[model samples]
Target: MERPQNMSIAPRIAVGVIILFHAVGLVGLSLPATRPLFLQVVPWHLLLMLLTIVFGHYKLSGRFKAFILVVFWLGFFAEWIGVHKGWLFGNYAYGTTLGVKMFDIPLMIGVNWFLLVYSAGVTMQRSGLKNGFVRVVTGAGLLVLLDVLIEPVAIKFNYWQWIAGSIPLKNYACWFLVGAVMLYVFELFNFKKQGIAAPALLITEFVFFGALNLVIGLWPL
Candidate 1:
């Protein structure tokens, strides 16, 4: 018997398994006591970078690749500066959200945000967005939209430990500004075109974490 070339069991099964795990995690998060804590430690942000690499969205034209690398490093440094100097995110300080510290900030947290913004740049490119006004605006908007989902979860889970209660609108505005400008730079370098494989990456993330969050009960365990 000849199998269809288009038919492959591996990806289907892999994606299914990822979805299942995430779902279970989500379910565990529903408990009132567990919900806050559960949301904090989970590595959902890293999933974005994982998506980029697994789907081969990391490769780009040499010049563009270099540009993205610069942006990545810059994002990391910016986060470190923000956390330590208290210029942007405020004086709440980090605990579970940051995990461990390096240079008075969470090393892993810096890495996560860097990769997250990079992934956003990659996804925007894949969305057929380009280096124009509309594309740039649209791409930035999507990043903000994703944040909309992340913020409540972060606060609920005590990720940033907002001291004054609730996330400030200014904080969100800064997110949009940073993301939009970074993406704009990527577009300028034409790295945005390297996003053809973004759909697969996004699907992988959605299946994995979406399911995980679902199973985890969208709260803590």
Candidate 2:
């Protein structure tokens, strides 16, 4: 199924605005003192949720919708458990970026997980790959690959501080595992349809976050 003929612009603008803010955040974090403020607002994953919603509105199959939501929630739970146990993503505690928390897990953090996994799952679905196993494995791998760049920058800005010298491989491996499971679950849920609206939504997020970073650089707040 292709995208609906009557898509609205509001979602597009919402995504654009979110990206704009993130770009500003990136720049803001460049300043020594104001950096924390910028880091606080850049929940890079929220845009992913917006993207998922957009995909849904565009008429993604019910199975894909459930798949996106479930995979993300799985990651969300995993992150919460792993962070508390010092088994996943390291023992770094979250800062105000996610607001106040319980068990060292912020509610917004779970929201972020949902968005990230949802977007990733949709992306993998559209990659034209034939083997379900290969798609699931590769999709998870892609997420971990993206995380390799995201983790260091996040740590440097004090979004979260790792007690260890560096984030461990186990942390990334866990992410891959969760990602794979999510993808498998999505497939199991039955997402054979061809329309998910991920391309535009993800592109929007990339632009939003990237631009937010740029604006933050310019304004330093």
Best by lDDT: 2
- Deviation (Å) of 191 in candidate 1: 2.9
Determine which window of 10 residues in candidate 2 has minimal summed lDDT: 1-10
* Residues forming the 10-long window of minimal summed lDDT in candidate 1: 1-10
Stretches > 4 Å off in candidate 2: 1-22, 31-36, 43-57, 60-69, 192-197, 200-221
lDDT of 2 by residue, 157-221 (tens): 55576777678888788878877777677667654443444444455555544554554456543
Query: To one decimal, what is the Cα RMSD in angstroms of model 2 from the true structure?
Result: 4.6
**Tens-digit per-residue lDDT, 96-182, candidate 1:** 654666665655664555455555666666665434666667666666666666655556555566667767776667677777777
On TM-score, the candidate that comes out on top is 2
What are the runs in model 1 whose C-alpha is more than 4 Å off? 1-25, 28-55, 58-69, 129-131, 195-221
lDDT for model 1:
0.55
